[model samples]
Target: MSHRQYAVTHTDIEKLNARLLSISLSRDERDWQSVFHTHHFTELFFVVSGEGNFLFREKLYHIKTGDLVIIPPYMEHTEQSIPDTPLEYYVIGVDGISFQPAGEQTCVQVFCNVSNKALVEEIFSQMLYEMRNPAYGSDKICQDLLEILILRIIRSQHVIPVPIASTYMTKECARIKEYLDSNYSEPITLDTLTDLTHMNKYYMAHSFAKYTGKSPIQYLNDRRMQAACTLLRDTDHSISAISASVGFSSQSYFTQAFRKKYGMTPIRYRQSQAGDDAANGS
Candidate 1:
C-alpha cells in the first residue's frame, strides 16, 4: 500500500450517505480465482481470516487476515486465496463520496494489519443487520460508520495519532469518567461511583466537577443524553425504549431531563431532525 494521502474536506463528508448497492460476507477457504472486474461505486474490502493476494491492475499485493483494502470506483482488481487458506472477507459498496489519489500513481490503497479489526467487523455487522431489517435512519447510521471506516484506514497509516487529555484527573474522577463512558447505558448512581472508586461522595463530586467542569452525575447524564439523541434520530425505537437503553430510570424522567437539557421533548427533537433529513433528501 502506498502513502497516497488525500485531503477530505467537510463538503466531502457532507456528501456522504449509506445507500449501499450491495454487501457480501464471503469465506474463500480453498483456492479461488476471479476475473479482473471494476465497480461503479467505491468499496471497503476487509479480510477477516485466511491468506490471499489481491491483484489490482495486475500488481499483486499480499493480503491476509486483518487487511482492509479500499477500491475506488473503476479500479480493476481481482483476488485469489492461498492454496490451503481461504479468504474470509466483507465487501461493502457505497455511493456519494469524493476521493482524490495522493502522490504517486497507485493502483490501490490498503490499510493492513489493522489493530481494530474487530471494531471494523462489528461496525460492518451492525450496518448489514440494519440494512436487512431497514430501521429508521439506518442508512444514515451505516453511512456514519462508513465514514468511521475511512478514518480508521487513514489512522492505521500512522501519519499521526489523536491526542487525549493530558490533564491529571484526581484518580477518582478519571475512574468515574471511564466507568460512565462504558456503562452509561446501565444504571449509575453516586453510591455506585463512590463504592467503585472507594471515595466519599462529596469528595468525588467536588473533584469531578473541578477537573471536568461538571459533576459526576451530570457527566453521566450528558453521555446518556448524547446516546439518546442518536437513537431518537436514527432508530424507530419508542421514546421509552430509548430512555431505558440509555439507563434512564423511567421514561417520564428521561423526558424531563431531556427537555431540561435540550429545551424540547425527545419526540419533538426527533421529529425536527427527521424533517431536516427529509428537507436535505437524506
Candidate 2:
C-alpha cells in the first residue's frame, strides 16, 4: 500500500477584542417609529424582509431583503419603511471594533444583495434565540457567533476590522451622547446630565464639547431639529405640534431655531421639501 502523509502547519489568527452589547429584532406589526439617532458602538443592520430607505449622512439609500449595513460609532442614521411593504429587520450593537472597506477611508459600509442570505439570516436568528433564552455558556456562544458574523462580513465584503481604543473620556462622552439621543424630547439640563453621569457639570461639558465639537445642549438641539425635520416632511402635524413633539416648549422658539439652522422659516423649509418631492414625482 502506497500512502503519502501531509504535514499540518499552525496558523496564527489575530485576536479580535470586541463585546456584544445588544440585539433585537424589529417587525412592522410593532409599528415602530424610526428616529435619527447615534450610538457609541458599531451597529449591524440586516434586512430580513420588505423594503425601506436608510437615512445616513443626510442621504437616503434604498434597502430591501438580504441587505446588510454597517454603521460606525457616532454616525447619525434612521430607517423608514415603504407604507405598503413595511420593514422587518435585526439590529445588533457591538463595541470595540469598526469596519473599513478596502480602499475606502470611511468606516461605514453597505452590502446589498448578499449572496449568503440564508446563512446570514440563520446566524442572526440563532443570536436572537440565544439572547432570549440564556443558559450556561450562552454568553460565550453569542460572543463567538458575533465574531464569526464579523469575520464572514469581512471576508465577503473585503472590509478591514479596526480595533477601537476605549478611554475614560470616550466612555463618559458616549454615555452623555446616548442619553441626549434617547431623551431629546424630555426636559434636559446640565444638572440632568450631571445626575445621570455623576461627572462635574463643567468638566463634563468641556470634555463632551472636545469630543463632539458641540456642547451637550447644542447636540440636544440638533437631535430635536433632526426629528422636527422628519416630522415636517412626513406628517401633517402643525408647526406647534411638531415643535412640542420634538421637545421645544414653544412654536416661536422652535421656528427661530429652525431658521437659524436652515436659513429659512420652518414653513418655508417644509414647502421647499414639498416642492422638491412633487418635482420628482415622489
Candidate 3:
C-alpha cells in the first residue's frame, strides 16, 4: 500500500506472460489447521466441486462448487474444506507482463481476477485445445485466449481499476481510489486529492462522479464503511475503537454514519452478526 506505487491503467494484449499454471481435480483430506501465506504474484482458485470457507484476512468467504476467488498480490488468506467430498479445482498463478506507456517507457503488470466462472471455462477450454493441438499457430491462439481471460475477469469484477475508454481518465481515478484505500485512516480534502491527480478540483469532482458513480467524499465514506463492516464482523474492538480506526473524527459521527448506511448502530450490527455466527456454529 505504498503512496507512490505505479497504477495499472491498461491491458497488455500482445506478448502476454506465459507460465505453467497447474490445476488439480483431486486432493487428500486435511484438518482445521491454519495455512496462512502471501505471494508476490496474484493467485486465482476455482472450486469446480467442493465446499469450504475461505479466510480472507479477517472475514470468512464461503466458497462452494463453481465458486471463484481471486487473491490479490500480498493477500494473507487460507481455505479449509468443510465437506468430506474430494476437492477439485483450477488454480492459476498470474505472471507479470511488460507494457510500454504512451511515453514509450516500459512497466510491468501482473494479471489477476476476483472471479468469473464463464470466462474461466472458456479460457480453460481454449488452453486445453491449444495444448492438445500444438500446431503452428497454437502459441498465438494461447496468447489471445489469455488476453480474453484477463478481459473477462476485469469486466466482471470491480476490485482492480482497469482502463476505461481513456487511459488518462483511468490513471487519474485510480490514483484517487488508491489514495483512499491506502490512507483511509487520515482525513482527506478536495485540495489534497486534486493535488494528487493534478486536476482542477471542480473538474475532478464532476468527472469522478460520472465515472465511479460517487463523488470523492462519498467514495471515501463508503470505503470507511467497508472497513467498519470488516471490523465489526471480525474484531473484538469496541465501537469507538472501530470508528477511530476507520478515520471517523468522533464517535457520534461514526454512529450516525453507520446507522444511516446499515439502518442500525455499530454496536447493534456487531451484536446481530455475532449472534448469527454463533447460531451457525462458526
Candidate 4:
C-alpha cells in the first residue's frame, strides 16, 4: 500500500463527532468460516489472536495476531480459521463520521502491523467493559473512547518517529536505520555508520541504542535476517549462497542466528511455509 501522512491534533480529535455503533469480541475454539457480511457503518477489526485467511470482498489475505484491518461501510468480508489455530478478535463499529484524519483526506491504509498488542487489547477490553455496564455518563465516555480507538487506527497507519531526548539524536538514529534498510546485503560495520554520520563510534552506538532500541550491529543483523527470511521462503537458494547474499560471513553463523531468532533452521522454516501453502491449497 502507498504511504500517506496526516497531521493530527487533540483539538481535531475533540471536534470529531464520531459515534459508536457496537462492540463485539469473539474467541473461536473450532475451525470455522463466517458468512460474507457487509454493513452500512464502518468496522475496525483488530486480530488479537490466531492466524487465518481473512477474506475481503473475494480476495484473501493471510493474517495473524497483531494485524489490524479497517473495513469501511459496504465492504463485504469474511474469515476462515486455520485448523488448530482459531482467531480471537474484536470488532468495533462506528457511524456519524468517516475516518477523516487531520491533513489531506487521503486513502487510509487498511492493514497495520501493530507492535504493541497489549496496549491494543487493553483499550478494546476497556471499551467492552464500559459497554457491558453503563453508568451515568458511560455513553459519552464510550463515545470518546471510540474516538480514541479511531485515533489509534490512524496512528498505526503511519510511520511516525518517536521523539527522543534530543532531536539530532533521533535524526541520526533514523539515518542509521535508513542506511541499514538500503544496505542490508552489503558489508556494514559500526565504523561505517559512524563515518556516514560523522559521529564517534561510541556516541553513535549509544544514541542509536537509546532511540531505536537496538545496537548498531544488532540492527544491521536484524535487517539482514529479515531479508534472509524472504529469500528462504521464496527462493531455492543454498544456505551458503543465501548467507553470503545477506552479508553473513559464514553459513554456520547465519544458521545459528536464524535458529536463535526463529527457533528453527532456515530449511525447516521453508518446509513449514511450504506445508502451510499445501494445507491451505493456495
The digit string of per-residue lDDT tens for model 3 on 1-282 reads: 657777789855544343434333334366336576655445556776677777854468777776766664444577777758655666666545212223322121222334556657667667666766689988677666766766565456433332223212356876786787789879888998998999999999987775445799988898899899889999999988998999999999999998998899999998999999999999
Residue-wise C-alpha lDDT for candidate 2, range 72-127, written one tens digit per residue: 88878998888788789999999888877788654664654578999999999999
Work out the TM-score per prediction: 0.46, 0.62, 0.56, 0.49
State in Å the error of residue 12, model 3.
27
Candidate 4, residues 1-282: lDDT per residue as tens digits? 999999865553345555688999997876454876656566778888898888853268888998878765444578777878888899988765544334523222267677787888888888889889987888888787776766676676652221112222356776787778779889888989989999889988988775445798987888788789778878999989999999999999999999999899989998998998899997
lDDT of 1 at 92: 92
Top TM-score: which candidate number?
Answer: 2
- lDDT-wise, the better of 3 and 4 is 4
Which pairs clash (backbone N, Cα, C closer than 3 Å) in model 1? 28-86, 29-86
Q: Model 2 scores what on Cα lDDT?
A: 0.86
The lowest-lDDT stretch of 10 consecutive residues in candidate 4 is 159-168
Clashing pairs in 2: none
Better of 1 and 2 by TM-score: 2
Candidate 2 C-alpha error for residue 241, in Å: 20
Q: What are the lDDT scores of the predictions, listed in order?
A: 0.74, 0.86, 0.67, 0.74
